[model samples]
Target: MLPFTYALRNLFRDPARLLQTVGGAALVVLLLIAAVALNEGMNSVLENSGSTKNVILMGKGSEESIERSEVPLSAESAVATSVRGLQEVLGVSAVSGEIFYQAPLHIAQGKESQALLRGVLENALLVHRSVQLIDGRFPQSGEVMVGHLAHRKLGVAEEDLAVGESLYFGDTELKIAGRFIAPGTVLESEVWFDRNDLAVLTQRDSLSSVTVRMDAAEFEDVEVFTLQRNDLELAAISEQGYYDKLSTFYEPIKVMTWVTAALVAAGALFGGLNTLYAAFAARIREMATLQSIGFTRKALFVSLIQESLLATLTGTLVAFILGYFILDGLAVPFSIGTFTLTLTPSVIGVGLITGVLLGTIGTLPPAIRCLAPSLPSALRSS
Candidate 1:
């Protein structure tokens, strides 16, 4: 068997080749980390954004998008009185009629871009239990409260959406009354408006949906109500179910992300393979010499694998360091909201496994070919 020091010593024999191997592995591993983290971040946000105990009541045939749904303004009152076993706080039912809108909103003396808007009453907090008012007061008439991460979605500076600033919706100017956060959810990227104010500004006479929080009520109760209330023409769905469907809807985005990363990594992988082939081809005579010295072919092969592993593992370390600094806690904005990227245990595991596979499987072709020639022929050849 080759001594551990033998493989270590051989790694530095060609500084240029060592650099190429390490750099290629680093680039490939980093790309994998980014791709996996991105998908995880997106899925986490969408999955955590909704709750199984909550049910959304939207207009018939509008289950896919609340923004397009239109329910009568009286639906909120009807659900509260009709639905049994609803959650309540101090006798106030946990029911909220809300309007969801997306439109171009202008900052005070800044750019205009599309922003997600949610119109709700104070009781909205009852249904969206994750919401926490971190600053100032909730929005009243002529006022709005921005989500803590809303600026990221709007592509504006953080200070632009701070409390005391103002946002413009057409000719209407709404004061930024506060900042709130709903961690791990899409709500953190929306701007909340007073229910009345939003209806007036958007010229909406109807609501997008009514959200109800259940305590002892089963989903069947809600579905039964929808069926009984034929005149209302409502659709009942669990909040968690809605988000799960949204995850399925975004499946293509995840696929595209992986495809793009694979394409870029493929280029780097091929370059690394070519480099390894040349480096190993040059060492054929050395491998043959070791085999002739009573060392088994398997032992030489193991040493070559050790060298490759060392370089790839070093690159993997580099990738983890970079990912921690750059991707961890990074906020990524999408159509619905923002999600933070973290180097979670799953992501790190994937990266480490990828590094190991690249070291072993990626080295096989060149390693096998390098040892293929007989000891006599290898010794005679260059």
Candidate 2:
């Protein structure tokens, strides 16, 4: 068997080729990381947005979109009185009638971007355990609380979303009263305001949804209530289940991201293959000489693989470092909300596995072809 050191040393024989191979592999790995990160971040946001202990009561036909749903204002009271095992906070049932609106928000004198706005009552905090006021105070009339990633979604600077700053929602100018965070959830990209204030601005007389906190065991009661109340046209769904549906709805987009990455990586693979072929061809005579010295073909093949793996692994390391510094925790905005790309354990595992596969698969054909000829022919030719 060839010593591992022999394989390692051979990589540096032509520094230019080594760099090119490593650089190509690094680019491919980086692209794969980005693709995986995008999908992971988006999925994480949607999956974390919901809580199993909470239930959302939306209009029956608009189960897919809370923004389009319209539940009667009286449904909140109905759900509280009718449902059993609902959580309570300070003698008040943990129920919040919310209004959701999507509108263009003016963040500066001339800048505007589309944003998701949620209108919440005080009890909203009790039910939304993921949310926490990190700065200033909760919103009041003519005031709005921005999410941590709201500025990113709004295409504005962080300073523009600070407390005391003002933004325009339609013709209404609202002050930024606070900043809140709902970590790992899509709520981190929304603007929250008083329900009545939003109702007035959007001229929405009806609530979008009523969210209630209850035990999982009591979900059937809420569901039964929804089914019994034919006049209300209400539907009950677990908050977690609602977000799961959203994730499923966006699955195609995530798949397309992977497809795009695969296409680009295929191009890189082919480019790397061509470079390896040339490099191996140049070393045919050297390999034949080693064969004459009693080195088995399998041993030579293993050494070539080790060399390829080393270069690709180096590239993978560079990709990981770049992803951590440049991509991780970076906020990306989409139609619904913004999500921060994270270099999670699973994503890192995928990147590492992809690198190993590239190294093994890209080197095999080239190495085999270089060793195909008889020893005497290889020695005579090159």
Give the alpha-carbon lDDT of every model.
0.94, 0.91
Writing each residue's lDDT as its tens digit, candidate 1 over 207-267 gives 9999999999889998999999999999998999999999999999999999999999999
lDDT of 2 by residue, 1-382 (tens): 9999999999999999899989888989999999989998898888888998989999988999999999999998998888878888778989999999999998756689999999998899989988999999999999999999998998888988999999998777899999999998888899998999999988999999999999544888889999889889999899999999999999899999989999998998899999999999998999999999999999999999999999999999999999999999899999889998999898899899989988998899999999999999999984
Count clashing residue pairs per candidate. Answer: 0, 0
Scanning candidate 2 in windows of ten residues, the lowest lDDT window is 214-223
- Native-vs-model 1 lDDT? 0.94
Residue-level error in angstroms, candidate 2, position 115? 0.5
All candidates: CA RMSD (Å): 0.9, 1.4
Best by TM-score: 1
Q: How close is candidate 2 to the true structure, as a TM-score?
A: 0.97
Clashing pairs in 1: none
TM-score for all models, in order of appearance = 0.99, 0.97
lDDT of 2: 0.91
